[model samples]
Target: MSLDTTTAMPTNGRPIPDPVPNDLTLPQSVDVVVIGAGIAGVCTALELAERGLKVALCEKGDVGAEQSSRNWGWVRLSHRDPREMPLMVESVRLWKGMNERTGAETGYRQCGITFSVTTDEALKEEEDWAQILQEYQIPARVLPAPEALNAFPGLTAPIKGALYNPHDGRAEPQKASPAIANAFRMLGGTVHQNCAVRTVETSGGKVSAVVTENGTIRCSSVVVAAGIWSRLFLGNLGIDLPMLKTTGTVLRTDPVPDGPEGTFKFQDYTFRRRLDGGYSISGPQTGLYEITPDSFWLAPKFFPALKSEFTRLKFRFGKRFVQEMKLPRKWGATDRTPFEDTRIYDPQPDTKAIDKVYAQLQAAYPAFQGVGIAQRWAGYIDVMPDIIPVVSSTEGVRGHIPGLFVASGLSGHGFGLGPGIGKLMADLVTGAVPVVDPSQYRLSRFSDGSKIAPMEGILRR
Candidate 1:
């Protein structure tokens, strides 16, 4: 298929220049065609290409232009859902060796992560969570007041204790995905940027090809890792994916001397040091939800999650509500879809929230009082009703769409879980032994009469 050479508008977040040139010609056919060039997509392509399968990765925008690059760069297993703990464990293991495996600096570092607490109730909650981690042989522990202070020196505020994980880590958000994509390219995988896939074409009730704005490519399997755009993409194929989006704002500070060496999440804010000597900071618990048509349609499925995280999510209705209402939910393969309309989901940063977090950071640690803001931006996160990702195939069921697999709905945790999830996805596609049990992340859970709720005592951060 002949491809287009149009370049997308420059993304607004941290700049991640193209690390590898995109493939201009779409192959006539491949063993597997993965849609969306985010971390999951590239990782999946890399795994398949390394396994000697012809792979093609398609992206509507630049790699990691959305949540992958806009995140706080935390690769942690400190306070994960119990169901996701195993996957996170494997993900951290992959992250530790990612730079060597990919031959690119992913900026991964085992700097540890700490959650500070100021009250006995909060400390008890951390202690309870630590007990769960112990069952998995994860080396996470709770420190008492004196010990917590000594572990995290330079704290002016008094704290009862903290939950510390020495193995938790961080990676450069802008560098990780592109590095993996480059690795895939080195392994003979094809990547197409500014190539928005309009719809997947099926034949004989099975996968056949995908129709992109550029053209069509035949394949036996397809993996949709389009992040926030996954719901709309699947909806076009008559699939009801229960997903909603929340906007998260963040800011980077000028390189300041002697900031916290490790990632830290206190009562009001979170911050982690960058490789460039600056610090990425944001409100650990703050997120803005813009009401949309899907918000009402999927409310029942998300009621439990909404109630559990009500204190952290701020609701608003304005341009976003009107904008989403006007977006076409269904489109033909030949049509110009919303994916082309907005190449990247770049939302305006909530200055109110960013400033509030900055103020709290200064109040909690006086060292941040003189830090200068370098840049501020916002990205939308796609969250599932259960706050867990769906990583299953759509085959052999009633009215099944064979050879279709989804690895989306990461719920703001994609960056840390990308490598492991990608490896698992490659196994699922090729019918090999999975790296971790895949039953918990099955897509059928939403429709199979299973009770959906966040794991007990899971941290919102």
Candidate 2:
């Protein structure tokens, strides 16, 4: 099948990529039932299937329909929370080989990334983080003022310095997960789209099987990489995963030649060179926080996270509050779930915010002056208190639910971190040695006495 998504925006109105045909026949048994076909779930299933495990990959919507395909697509290692450095290093390695492994166009390019700092305080913060990277033996350096300004062509912004990592990269979000999922299918794995797993049926405090909308799938274990819907899914299993959702608006411009060599970030906005010659632009810190029921419910737990992200966020309380307020917390297997009702969690786009960021991009870089926006979109990014992901077993903390694993609360960095988390989760499920240390990503950090905090100065994803 010819893949033609040139005009598709992966938003609500436009058609997203669906290269991976749905596997309608649900198998009676599989060694693992991987829930949610976003990057996390799809990559995890691909890893397990490659390891000779019978895996069933299930999704409430098409693969990469939600945040997976709707992100800024910056596969960077700069300014990451120190805890994620190891996994990010692994992710970069996996990304380097993703196209070769899948035999598909993932648009993975090691074009480098620059976290530009226009203020002295920001430069100092960037220097501190660069030191952390140095300690980790990661090649990240803070460039001086003139060096930073000269690095990005057609630049007019007075940037003091920047933390640059040449090994960082970018990828096409619309193609990554689907390519990996197609590779999984070619390997004889099964995929079920529009399949909402209502709950995991447990036996003797351990997971026995997963009951989906279509039928039951008997599996030894289940991995929930359900993205924004993970908290709700876990709530049904009597497990609580504290999460808050933020809306990030993004737009792609018409192809502009010689804008910049790679991805560049300013305080107000971020722009990356896309594989299509166009640039994906968005406000990095201008994430709009839509008030929901979870905001108040998880306030105490998320207070510190909010404090760090407060300056970069804009708040609004409207219909989304009511929409989330009415969602049922618990539901039976046969009953209809919020997941089935909303296959694509495409929220309303904040065009005004996006337009403001676009104006800034044009002012800083002259190449974007006359570029027309090809498409504009938005997505709800789930965030944990630590602004990182929880890629651990359910039994890690309280043994509340055995035979279950979670890879959620990725904040806005899920797209870049997906493959590494997928590989890590697969290792945990099979009882194999992990690719990186998983202690920082444990779900028990909230309940346990671990000092829950974001990396230096509490940065947002």
Candidate 3:
């Protein structure tokens, strides 16, 4: 299979620069092939192309439709895993200039991120994190309750205080992914959405081509950036990853006269003040549980009491969740057909959850007292058992495969760390000085009898 590098206008309406003759076909062989169209894949392609390498990036779905777009858009420098801080720090820099890089409105904001704590335990943990961040010269501090209220002016709830990181901010993940993908195309890279890689063709123990539904793309190297689906790709090469899908629910409020001017996180979930005077809130990033279709049925088997209440109270189940529960248990493990309806897993707002979230928000900040609930949606994210991302090449796979790489297992931090990981992966692919040490994210670490401990809940955050 060859790429007919004809500069045809994209059906999606994004402009494509004219393709040169050499660009018309995939090189009989290429320098690299990247799988997954999310941040990691596009970023790596852009970086490699910038360094003068021929790269091809393919995706099983539209870019960022999964964990990348499904995340709570916090681009903060606070509450980072020490190992991931370098990436976090550099991500903030890239985020600040993302518009120039992608030529798109990504909703980037540097309004700062505040973590409100009401207990001595949470406060102590915040203090500890402050010390570690300061060690890296990252600005972080625990503000007094009075000062916190003064800073935000609308935080009316009673609490000990809050930890503030001025360098932290956010962007609209919904728009950023596509924007970056467009940027990658403009930079002389190739991206194929709805194109799934069937298998990595290898010869003499080296990757020779990426067989996709469209055609065979011969390339010496491949990078796997598929989010939760990354493990499935590696499985094709005989590698098993301890990654799972975790669901999160979020709610939006009707445009109000006023709302919190910035973003906030508390015991129940975090709330981000939207540009439209509404707000978005979600569950704790670490609280999602392992739930299979059977788990819904198993929820009753495991906790008959909750099941009884679910039936007795007529507790509502999100449509997607209910449908997912009806599917065979194997569906979660084996369903691989990629759909174009981007909303295959898109969920409607949970009224009950929204009411609870609204109450909590009102309790935490009174300004939300009369905020009318407008809409809500839910999404799933990829999570590692240990909650640390495992990113590296598969062992025993070499040669043409030598250039193959991986940058996934984001474990709910994809939106926040996408830019940083993208930058680092790009560096590794181009063989340039890495933005952050790769050893921290090497996949072999977990197999070599060393395990990275999961974040200590709010303490580590």
Candidate 4:
């Protein structure tokens, strides 16, 4: 595949093996209807099925087609918010046994992840944060400058030290979600592709079912793991979910036999070794935000986050503002919604940004000098106001729509935290023992008098 930055469906990305899709035949009823077939949705369905709950996994497009597969495939516990630390710890644990649990290959490897810092201040911050990881008894430690650079070969990026999390690793993005979805199907879960869920039908403020483009499925509960489309989908239901999107561009290299082992975060760029022998590379440009109509409407909630990352994020206007304005905010259940309109949020990769990151990667690691660029792509990341996720039910609001649970706004941490989120969501839905304490991820935090803000400071890695 030629690394055409403008291509929407880049062929280089691991194509999720198309399974026996059930979009043609809609199910009559299910215990739960999971909207979106990303990592979180698929794993949630699988967990629900494992608990013997009939689940219908619906997606506007193919499984893992969006940010689920478009992510850097990094499964890490380093540099995470303390609120999510426990969940990430649980997520990493789930990641370890995913291949066996799904009876498929997820390309999971615990080779380790090294987050290098170029300054002593950053190193000190990381070291201070290591205390929380130590509380969890996670195998994470701070290494001195000399020892840090030695963790990965050819890591010539000028750095003072690093926080090495040997337990933090990666899984193949393209393969993991699809494999899990396939396993869910084998477990008797209905997998629907190209089935755009228009809206959730509520009865007396409780979710009665979800109306999809195909037909209505009488589900007791609905989990909106709709990634970037969550806020839009919820907006039609009168739920004011304060969320926004940021573009992330990633480039994959051709097979590099001697690429640095595991994942490494340079001062400007980051790379992870893939199963196919190539390395997925990205840089700070991932934080770029496009100005849309929602940006102005939700500016008050996001003002703090924007101010915190003023110098870090790049914002663009014009096209996105007009594009989002054209999207229907109020649609009837019988009408075609925007979910069907935009099957995949495939943004154009910034060619110049990719070139710059590539140049910097070669400069840092001379071993990557002549490696061929196989493919480059970009996807939008849905973020929340407090820079965390909402994996709770809809009963927190004034209108209080019951039987509706949401697991969206994972920001950029969805792929890594998918399993933990799924397990926790299933626990909440099934009234079973939670995988972790779900207090921090409640939907009420935004509406309640609780000071809705980011627990961690700027530049959340």
- Residue 420 of model 1, lDDT score: 86
Model 3 clashing residue pairs (backbone): 3-26, 5-24, 207-401
Ranking by lDDT: 2, 4, 1, 3
Q: Please, what are the lDDT tens digits per residue for candidate 2 over residues 1-461? A: 12215444332243266568999989999999999988899889999999999999999989889998888898978778878889988898899999999999998999888888877888888888788778767788899877776767768777888888887899998899999999999999999999999999988878889999999999889999999999999998878898889988888888997777678887778889887889989876457898888899999888888888777788889998998889999889899999999988887667777878888879877889878777777888999988889998986465477789998899778788989999999999999999999988889888987777677574643
Tens digit of per-residue lDDT, candidate 4, span 34-60: 999998899899999999999999999
Model 1 ranges with Cα > 4 A deviation? 1-18, 396-399, 459-461
Best by lDDT: 2
Off by over 4 Å in 4: 1-23, 458-460
Residue 386 in model 2: shift from native, Å? Answer: 0.9
Q: Write the per-residue lDDT of candidate 3 for residues 286-358, one digit (tens) a residue.
A: 2334445534433322342233223222233355456444533222222343322232345333445555766
Consecutive 10-residue window with the lowest summed lDDT within model 4: 9-18
Judge candidate 2 at residue 193 and give its lDDT: 94
**Clash pairs (backbone) in predicted model 1:** none
- Model 1 agreement with the true structure over 1-461: per-residue lDDT tens digits: 11112223232344453466889999999989999988888888888898899999999988878788888899988788888888898899899989999999999999988888888988889988788788878788998767665644666657788898888889998889999999999988999999999989899878999998999999999999999998889888888778999988888877878766778877788889998888889885558888998889999999988888887888988888889899998889878999998888778887667878887888767668777776777888999998998887865333358899999999988889998899899999999999999998988888888999887556354
TM-score of 1: 0.94
Clashing pairs in 2: none
lDDT of each: 0.84, 0.85, 0.65, 0.85
Query: Could you tell me which 10 consecutive residues in candidate 2 have the lowest summed lDDT?
Result: 1-10
